[model samples]
Target: MKQPSIARLPRMLKLVLTRRAGFGVRLALVGAVFTLIAGFGEASAQAQTQLALKFKAGDTYQQKVTTRTISGGEVAGEQVKTTLQQEMLISTKVESLTEEGAGNLSQVIEQITLDIGLPKGKSIAYDSNQKEFSDPILASLHKTLGKLAGARFEFTTTTSGEILNFKMPAALTEMAKNQPGGGMMGDSLSEANLRRMFEDAGVSLPKEPVKKGDSWTRKASVKLPIGEVTSHLVFTYDGPENDTLERIVVSGDVEIAPAEKSPLSVKLNSTKLTGLTFFDRNLGRVDSSSMSQVLNVTVAAGGQTNDLTIESQVEMKIVPPKK
Candidate 1:
């Protein structure tokens, strides 16, 4: 073969080297993109299996709650019955969190409405937003309920949603401050009951990761007009129901416990509680929740006993983050 020129040799080698380098760079870029996508998919799968609150600061939830109670059995061989209904608007925010994942939250009441049926075909309704009411008693109660608006309460909880500490306010006392007979409804709005109403409804996660059919138990002592009630809240994991949501089922029982001696006592009572919640892993919170309770109770007072049954329901959902 004839000898080639030295200048042409250098150009030929340069072209070959440049082509190899470019091919390697393109291969590396493709691999990096694939790795990133695979990592994202793996993280999502892990989240669905893991059970924990893992709350972020400043997250907020809006809740609508409704409660209906009908308590009627027999008093002195006469049938007696009454129905009570209540609706509320509540907002919950995670104020701050601890290194161990515990969190402090601020719960605010925005609105409240109530309807109570009285004897002899009489019924009264109270709406805090109403400017005027026909009955003075209803008007007074409306004004009392107004105090709840803009009320903020701070508390701490475990990742599982169990209430660790509650800054319970003198709710009934505050609601009754300017009312004519604050004392009559004061006990019915006691701090203990209100605290449980907000806290116990929280999502209680399992100690360990759970799959379908897994179950756990939680116990709480709540005070109500019928008396102090100790309840056992049972939780069941139905596992991952869909791409973004996890389903949890709840059922519980409440029993009258020995409490302070007072006319406010339950002679006999039956209780049942059921609930379901859907959690969004990507959002890191419950998307929506619904819970209901039924109570059939016999209330005893000075020389008399009254039968009562009550049904209560609550639903909640996370709202978009504040700007």
Candidate 2:
């Protein structure tokens, strides 16, 4: 073959490199945004339903969470992972529910055996009792970081369930205040932000006349720091007295760019309802035989589609104290 010009070769190489780098950046950005949206949506849903449950003291329940992520239409090859084990304890007063422990992938699994005392107007306190972890490195780091980061944290929360007011040990608070993006400091929950989100979404509680098999769908237009997104929340009451939420389906479309958007959506379908029980007299209920199916997770930025399916069942016994 005839010798090619060096100058032409360099120009072609530069163009190829530039194109590759741009593609990589776009892919990363799309993935990050999708992950954030999924996570935020789940958190928002949990906060909204947290207070709706009429749980009494001495009531306890356990739940397991399994999650998997798919990108560019391919199963990230990682099997379903058990994210956490949840233990919810309800106190005599409505504001005293406590979450015992949570397991994270990176850090040591710590038992958050803190009791929440909801005094008045979103004022809350954390009384840490015991600490347990399997990893030695994590334990040591947690001990040093926990104290340095204010072992005990308290704050006033926002209505959207996002933490707004944070009160940490003086030393930790000062340190965080000195750092950038440290506003979170020592806050645990943010009720104010959550309430604001619900307000913007035009979400409302189901009216008292709610009966079995009644379903309601609401549309929420959310404006995040990055962009605007729309979400649909569909709630259905499968049992009488609205004791159990038989089905909850969430789906939405998000705009990734001016000309491109994600037809991204998710549907949590129910297949079986087992161990479903309710005690209206005492404000207690349990659904030991409930299962859900997640289907069709799509990302439309790079012309890729990933289909994901999730099957989960939760079992628990909740007994409310005498009213």
What are the per-model C-alpha RMSD values against the true structure? 13.2, 27.0
lDDT of all predictions: 0.71, 0.34
Error of 1 at 297 (Å): 3.1
Model 1 agreement with the true structure over 1-323: per-residue lDDT tens digits:
98775455445344444464677775675566567768988876555366677667887777766666665667777776677888777788889998878888888887788888976688888777776778878766765566676677778877777776677556645653444332444344455666777765467787587767778888877654345668788888787779988888989887786446555667546777999989876766677888788888777778776776667776766555334
Runs of candidate 2 exceeding 4 Å displacement: 1-92, 95-189, 192-205, 217-231, 239-323
lDDT of 2 by residue, 81-112 (tens): 22222232222122233352111111111222
The lDDT, on a scale of 0 to 1, for candidate 2 is 0.34
Q: Which model scores highest in TM-score?
A: 1
Point to the candidate with the largest lDDT: 1
